[model samples]
Target: MRNLIFLFFIVLAISVTSCRKDFSTIPSFGQLEFSRDTVYLDTVFTNIGSATYNLKVYNRSNKDITIPTIGLERGNSSNYRLNVDGIPGKTFDNIDILARDSIFIFVETTVDVTSVPDPLYTDRILFDNGTNQQDVDLVTLVQDATFIFPGRDPISMEIDQLTLDGEPTAIQGRFLEDSELIFTNARPYVVYGYAAVPANKTLVIDAGARIHFHDNSGLIIDRDASLKVNGTLNEKVVFEGDRLEHVFSNVPGQWGTIWMREGSKENEIHHAEIKNAIIGVLVDATTSSTPTLTLKNTQVYNHSNFGILGRGTSILGENVVVGSAGEASFAGTVGGSYDFTHSTFANYWNNGIRALPAVLVNNFFTFTNDQGQEVIEPRDLTQANFINCIIDGNNNVEFIPDRVDGATFNFNVSNSMIKFNDINGSFTGVAELDFTDTNLYQNITLNGFADFRNTSANDFIIGQASDAIGLGDPTAAAQVPMDILGVIRTLNPDLGAYQHISF
Candidate 1:
């Protein structure tokens, strides 16, 4: 009885193991995958016009699969035929199977929709391999017709003729409440030409906003209204042309000007990039007592005339760059109280900074003029103070003094560097000044003219040598603690932009 019971238990265990082996030996196939399951047509089309679309078919399986034919079907009905060769209604004959390969197919077809009817249509591409078939759907929607013109159009023709009073008139542009104005490229509009401040309105621009001008479009701020444009460092505002190719050319009077009209007050422009304009910023005598044009960390480049042409009443300019200009980068005519500091004026066709009377310049960098002989032409400048600055002039050119009649020009320089030419004969006009220790050169040139007065005062301290070391007011030697290049000023101040540091 014990033997029979053991034999029955052993046979039951063997039968269970045989069933597990049979289940494990069952065959399973991998999944079929595709790169894309849907296609989208972004444009809305009308009439019998045709559009071409590119489709990429990827083989994702490990084994190679053959695609014999692919055709488009609409609503379970073949509306149009797919072309494999040159003709329609043919199977793709030159098809091949490849493992992990992608093939691009171009499908060009005409729409059967008539007239200007807007509708959403669903179409699909069906691929057939004898009995096996797969379908990929495509969705497309048609929209209103858009006309593309060749070049920029006139500003007046582009915008709707709506006046400020909500009346029907041929007003060229519209102004939003958020101080934003959009100008289309239909017609060119001359701002500040017909009306200043957009017909009795204050112009305020948002930070990081862009004011695009069509070809030959400009704005002027009349004496009545004020212009306030303040931008942050990251999102600085821009005044640019609509088309990238159509920049403001170097032609005088080509575009309009910003005339701070008489009686206009409290105008502030900061952190802005004004590029490729005819004349960048023009400040005239019409400004009021409280009218202040404060330009800070702003860049003005590629202009026809001066970068900032100012006259009269307290303009504060700091950290500004005027580069690649046609004429003078800064042409300050007549009389204006200017407090300009920590600025760079470079690569101008004419003078870098042309100063008249009543200008106080401090802590600035002026590069050599590539076109003219002079860099900073101070014409009768009254009390021009240059502290901690760098002046570079190429071609052995001198800092020209403007020949203005009856103007007293006083230049006070401390801690600055001026180089005339590079070693390779490139014009890098940075002048060397050393004020810490007394060392004499064979010949010393002071302010473009040879000056042997106190030749011992030009020596720089060892290890504290710079281009702008001891060029400060010699009489006020005790007052200037350090040079412009951040070196400690000794008994005598350095002559150049940098002070010599021991170590």
Candidate 2:
């Protein structure tokens, strides 16, 4: 009797183990739930891979279910790639999930224009088989670009280089043809090398046109050439690096600059967003009586160096916001003519050791002569006028006026909020920051808290308690009828690029 009882116990244990091994293979019908029914991957350039997105496949039932098949409806011909539950393939079979558990389906795409029918690429991720099949739609807008790169001399395989800043650097570049000079929104332009606009030519970028550049590539306006970026409030022209990956989104120095060479004439940038560059707009030697670059309702930010570096150039900027640069946000160096109204120059650069201020006005620069001796050359700053503007930065003093007595340092700041604190007389010796002198500065609030809506995120919009509200010169505000966003400014408007907008 004892032996029979022991054998019965052993058999019961074995039966329980066998029952545990028997997992329910019956596929759960209509039991699968997804985080989203559709996934939109947004816009990506042709022949480039898009950022990976994920779809959560949930088993909401009480019993474990095995999806017999999970595959793209388009099969192997589809441009979209998928990875199901850690397995990468176009088709997956028997993907298992525990009760109340979920699995992730990763989706990515690198599509060629020729392989896709329409710019709006669409595909579906189908789950299960036959009647109980459920699917999630995958859609992405693919854009075909007119790629501009230097052509090699078929015999020599040599490309042209650019003589930038008196240094000849080997760069893959070519002059733009007449047909390519007029950029439109019909198709984006992805430039791999520098696109030089020849002398006497003009490159007009229409509103909503997207211009993407590769690393170290930029647009060069030769002598007598021009660049007119006609952007609007709703649709602004975008100039950025071609690295569409999320990692490069806010990075600085991704590309070169919109270099308006010494004699480039009548270059105008309006309602444009120029970002992620070494120098946003490098205006060189514009000595015209009229403004060389008329920047209106434009934003040039996230530059590694100066946002708008005017080396003896003339600029008349209105409703401009320049933010976050390794050096100064707006540098009028070696003297230049600059008149900024309703503009904001805020530098909250925590990237590195930023020694310069937000706005730098200097009248001279030191350079080595042929004999290797340091020679200071005078470049008279005819005018560095800031009216109804907000110039603030993380530093105690955001405005720097480095003047050489021999050269002229003509600057006027009226009805503006500046961050200048010289309690220690660090900058008080300079006449520009001497609050006692009304000729150089007037009605300027020193070290006034801008009360920015969000400084950490580079949002310069002011709040109710901010000192910038109603601090603008009504006369200057009348000139810039509208703010950067096209909002009609009141007679007594707030400072900065944007008008005082309440939430």
Candidate 3:
């Protein structure tokens, strides 16, 4: 037994010695290859952490190599953090790699505005030491802007409360000040929480203004408040997520919606682009006789839920485009007055299976009341008119009218291209259910092939061979003389928002 133990100890010692020989001690100069010389980390707002970016350090030589040190040039005081071979640290020592093998160097940053000299923060990743030292540039464009987040009490950090749907909810938000009412294009605005426009106030976004919201953050227009976006053709206002990386450009559900709450009025959005949100614009309650919202030459795309959700509200949209939503691209819910002219509502959502249609009109909603009983609310759909529009999607049926009896459901879809087939008998287009009558749905083509410029990439521009071309009412063209692109429309204009521009 003693002899066997001695032999086992000797074998273990030899194994440990052999394992140590895997790395080479030979010093190398200018032989290390990298996947990228300059790693561009994602752009981040002030004091916000960025996503981790990786760099591959390859050992191309035949022999194994040992990197004595791997660190940031800023040393311990650096804002950037590095991770080498799964070990998180600001600096790593004695990192070894086999021949033709590679190791990953992950880097992340969370910089404060006071730490950097300028908004463009730059650093270097130093590898090795002495005469053979090498480095790779690390650049991050840090943006400094006005951050509107939920303000809390300094002592207890207690958030404010807002009444939502008759329920008092704790929210991280505050009403806008007079100074903050006008958002400019000087710097990007980053919102951490809901930014509310109080009653009797108007928040105006200037041309070329870019507003980025963090997850679940959005703009809220309160009762009697207004939100007017003054964007132009050349410089459109952009509302999207805070992530500035290319990978996150079309990602859905990155943020919340521009919520126009009950009694909110006179909201106008023109030449604006809103994307990657759960719900693009949610307009609730039409308290006044005037239209609650007016959308012109605007795009609300890449939403997880409805692009435009109007709950008993009045909306007038022209030359608008709503694209790629998991639910209906435009949902006139619980009855509303909706008018869309020369607009395109297309949902080619390929990310997941979509069960709903692109355009949904409903006159009622069923919900449970506080008494624990199911309650149904009947809302009168005053009007839902679509003129010279394209309501199409990848699905066979892209339009659905969910109307309950007893409620007034009045709608007209004239000279439009719609995708609706009643093969399943779900919507038979009988009486008040759908707009199938010739008088109500006049000159409309049902399930016509759109032949769009590119459906996959969310381009709804119609081709020359499309059935929508030259189908617009000549009288309608005279009403709205220009298209979304500011192009003059002919007297007998093409259908949809773009007027069939040449590809």
* TM-scores for every predicted model: 0.43, 0.80, 0.90
Better of 1 and 3 by TM-score: 3
Query: Lowest lDDT 10-mer window, candidate 3?
Result: 152-161
Model 1 off-target regions past 4 Å? Answer: 1-195, 198-201, 245-257, 286-291, 348-386, 391-399, 407-503
Model 1 TM-score (2 dp): 0.43
Model 2 scores a C-alpha lDDT of 0.87
Answer with 2 or 3, whichever has the higher TM-score: 3
Global Cα RMSD, each model = 21.8, 8.2, 4.1
- Worst ten-residue run, lDDT, model 1? 21-30
lDDT per residue for candidate 2 within 15-42, as digits (tens), equals 9996574566558586699999999886
The CA lDDT of each predicted structure is 0.46, 0.87, 0.87
Q: Which whole-number lDDT from 0 to 100 does residue 67 have in model 3? A: 87
What tens-digit string does per-residue lDDT give for candidate 3 at 182-268? 999998988777888988999999999999998878999998899999999988999999998767888999999999998998999
Of candidates 2 and 1, the better by TM-score: 2
